[model samples]
Target: GGIPQVIARSYLAWWLGSPAWSPDGSRIAYGVYLEGSPDGDTVQIWTVNPDGTHPRLLVNLGECRAACAEGLAWSPDGSMLAFHSIRGVPAGTRAIYTVRADGSGLRRINRDGLQPSWSPDGSRLAFVRFPTPGGIPGEITHGELLTMASDGSDAIPVLEDVALSPNGLAWNPVG
Candidate 1:
């Protein structure tokens, strides 16, 4: 009886990246890229109850021309989610965005950042920043480990002089 159950099923699109759980574990949030759409392809965020009910669209991040929205992280208090969107512009420019769980207050936080993980206290977020911008799509390149305030300010480099391209992030749970 230890097997997990499927909570939801998608019809026309495939999930784009990792899904994140709310701080209290009451819900799950994930992104999906629409497929076979006459309008066009776009990545959108959605959240659903664990029982596969009440699936709702949170935000529509348009036109993932080269890269898709990946890496979803919920704020410790469950107020917002921070994730990166790789837009069609600049070829490979990745940017971070945060949106309220209820689909309000969506804003782009940083450019050239990915894999945003929240600090244990939710006061800051750490992400990977690419150096010199513009790189080959879907290829790992040199980057730096950097952190910034939850409001997307006060960015500081935590490590440098090393070839790094982080694919995921998590804070020490104990805090």
Candidate 2:
């Protein structure tokens, strides 16, 4: 591998995380944290060219009561993006969402999910669902791994009642 190079940088004091390259490898999608905004620290999705040009905002998850959007995943066809957002206060409800790459058709797929990963064929999405009552309380010791149709239907737990890492989810391309 060649020496690392910085292709993009956040303006002002915003922070960046959750970088996901499009399937075509032409654009990079990531979450930007607008720190100290009047509405609090909110996270929005943005895309930039591989060479760091034509930066565009794809999704603005307005006013996150707590932690907002993260764990962005691009569809196999590079037409859509999936991510998880935690909203509300004290309780901090979590949900999975998807939007077109052009910044439209934003939809919440799952009411309770995190760390979304699209299937290699782009036909399904897998995510983590922590148990209630203790809802992501400290280290996750009990949760379920679920997969659903691309449009968020027929969700079924592939694994349950296990200690799951909130950030661990992926699909084997060969599968």
Candidate 3:
């Protein structure tokens, strides 16, 4: 491995996490949390060139009352990006959304899903679905693994009643 290099830095951001490389490796997409904004603390999605140049805001979550986005994934052809947003848009629970690489065509895919992983062919996505919190406080009973068309239709559970890590879904690159 080569020496690590810092490509992006931010003093205004509360934190930056979930960096995803575009399929062509030309750009990186990530989420940033900015505190003390006019809309209070908010999370936004951004993209930057691999060389740390031409950073651009892709999605602004400031409109959501209290939304944060993470778990970004790029479509195989680099035409779109998928991410999970908490309390976004419809503003209640976490959901999956996609947007064009140029930061347009924003759309929600699944009403409840997280950590989306695009299928090798980019025709489908696999994600985790944690059951809503219940019973004792701060206790989660289990989660399910699901796959659906990239358009968010025909979702079918692959595994249910299992402990699935929120960020554990990944498709086989070779498939």
Candidate 4:
């Protein structure tokens, strides 16, 4: 093989997002796009091993109008994963959700947040939130730095006017 050797494959027809590795480095998780059966184009979360084994479904977010299961981050303890999805919400809206690695306890934590990053202690999640409204397809909107508990409660905006469009987020390891 080449320098970048091939790894695992999801075996799904289409994959729509990046793959995230568990904190313990045991598994990789990603989102698969299911298109045009009875459900139209939907994105679902899936997991696989580093060596391309034991692929399985993690979170089944039915019918993400735009995108789903993006910016996945494993909790420090490797218990859950936080990601953004357009599932179960109005079109053009993205939300943060967490699901257990074992494919249980799927819950939406925030309504309009994306690219969730877990705090060092795994007690809270920091994500980018689109606070201001109205924009064209490529136009930039105001994004805020927000944090919430692991269970998706008590959301507080930490910083206002972070950037016009924030893609990913991370917490300071020493902070």
Candidate 5:
């Protein structure tokens, strides 16, 4: 049973989104709203030592026009972080991206997907889509779930006609 407790809230910066712990448990990385956030033109990633001494800003998504970061994951090896964003590059598009845990070499991994979950081995990710380029919302249509490799190759349709939201899905950590 592994559950994390938010002992200290991210307060130095007001805009705090998803938070993921590094594999080594030395630091935590999360998305933060610099000044505008959610409605402003900027959102970014930041990290702080567990003792809360050395806080640092990792990646800024404001330039991409994304407003907020909602989901985040840490690579098993602690070398990288995978995160879901509503800002960056194309702007306003839901996507997945990764960057060094220390805030270096940020890159976009997926351009159009949502609800990113990393594989146990950290070599692949699972996500959901809106079936038909924006499938019927409200559970009115049947669209299967999808999966893809970490490099954005071999995007295979693993499920069929399940549901589509382009932003939501149901998955249990354990089955």
Candidate 6:
């Protein structure tokens, strides 16, 4: 389609989320949800080449269905993708994740995170991690912005109170 829109849930409808294009603008990583029923949604990772060819499903959430997943963004070098997943909180509990560009070597790189923004230099990525405490899930405990190396090292808290409500996270790259 010229402009994609929500194809509403049916038995096999796939509701696609925002599309994240690669740094070189050669491809896109996006979210897709296969409706289990009219009321059930299963989130997963999907990708399509820039030319809209070779569209493929990268990761299935069935293995991690207890978690909700979305918000896919690519690294500056187009070598990897950074996205978020939630561990079942109705609205969701998020964490950041990464995977190789070819769709191999998937990894859950962080806990309690969202909105992964990779630095232009490809050295680090910034994300928002929520503050969940006392095993209580209803409180709006506030989320803080964070940055970490691509290899999952040297995680640093950079900004706070920057996350938007409802979606719950955001971060901008440092120039």
In lDDT terms, which candidate is top? 2
Candidate 4 Cα outliers beyond 4 Å, as residue runs: 8-14, 37-40, 134-140
How do all models score by TM-score?
Answer: 0.88, 0.88, 0.87, 0.85, 0.71, 0.72
What tens-digit string does per-residue lDDT give for candidate 4 at 63-115?
Answer: 65556777889999999988887556356677788888888999888888878
Give one digit per residue, the lDDT tens place, for model 1 in 30-114.
8888876665877788998877788898998876764466789999999999988777566666888999999999899897788
Residue by residue across 108-156, what tens digits does model 6's lDDT show? 8886666677787778877766675421223344667678998778999
Instruction: Rank the models by TM-score, top first.
Output: 2, 1, 3, 4, 6, 5
The clash tally of candidate 1 reads 0
10 residues in a row with least lDDT, candidate 2: 132-141
In model 5, the Cα lDDT at residue 105 comes to: 80
Q: Which sections of candidate 3 miss by over 4 Å? A: 38-40, 63-67, 88-92, 134-141
Off by over 4 Å in 6: 1-11, 37-41, 63-67, 88-91, 132-141, 161-174
lDDT of 2: 0.82
Which is better, 2 or 3, measured by TM-score? 2
Q: Write the per-residue lDDT of candidate 2 for residues 1-175, one digit (tens) a residue.
A: 7877676686643667788999889999988778786767777889999778888989888766444668889999999999888885455788889999999999998888888999999999998888664445245668899999989999999999888767757899864
Give the CA lDDT, 0 to 100, for residue 159 in model 3. 93
In Å, residue 119's CA in model 5 sits off its true spot by 0.9
Q: lDDT tens digits, residues 8-94, model 3?
A: 777768778789999899999998888877767777899998889999999887634433677899999999999987774444677
Candidate 5 — what's its lDDT?
Answer: 0.65
The ten-residue window of minimal lDDT in model 1 covers: 132-141
The prediction achieving the highest TM-score against the true structure is 2
Task: Encode model 5's per-residue lDDT on 1-175: one tens digit a residue.
Answer: 5666453454445656666778789888777665544545467777878766677877766644333576677766888887766554444566777787767888787876666666667677777665355432233455556777877677877776774554444345452
Estimate the TM-score for candidate 4: 0.85
Query: RMSDs, each prediction?
Result: 2.4, 2.4, 3.2, 2.8, 4.9, 5.1
User: Compared to the true structure, candidate 5 yields what TM-score?
Assistant: 0.71
Candidate 3 minimal-lDDT segment of 10 residues: 132-141
3 or 6: which has the higher lDDT? 3
Model 6 TM-score on a 0 to 1 scale: 0.72
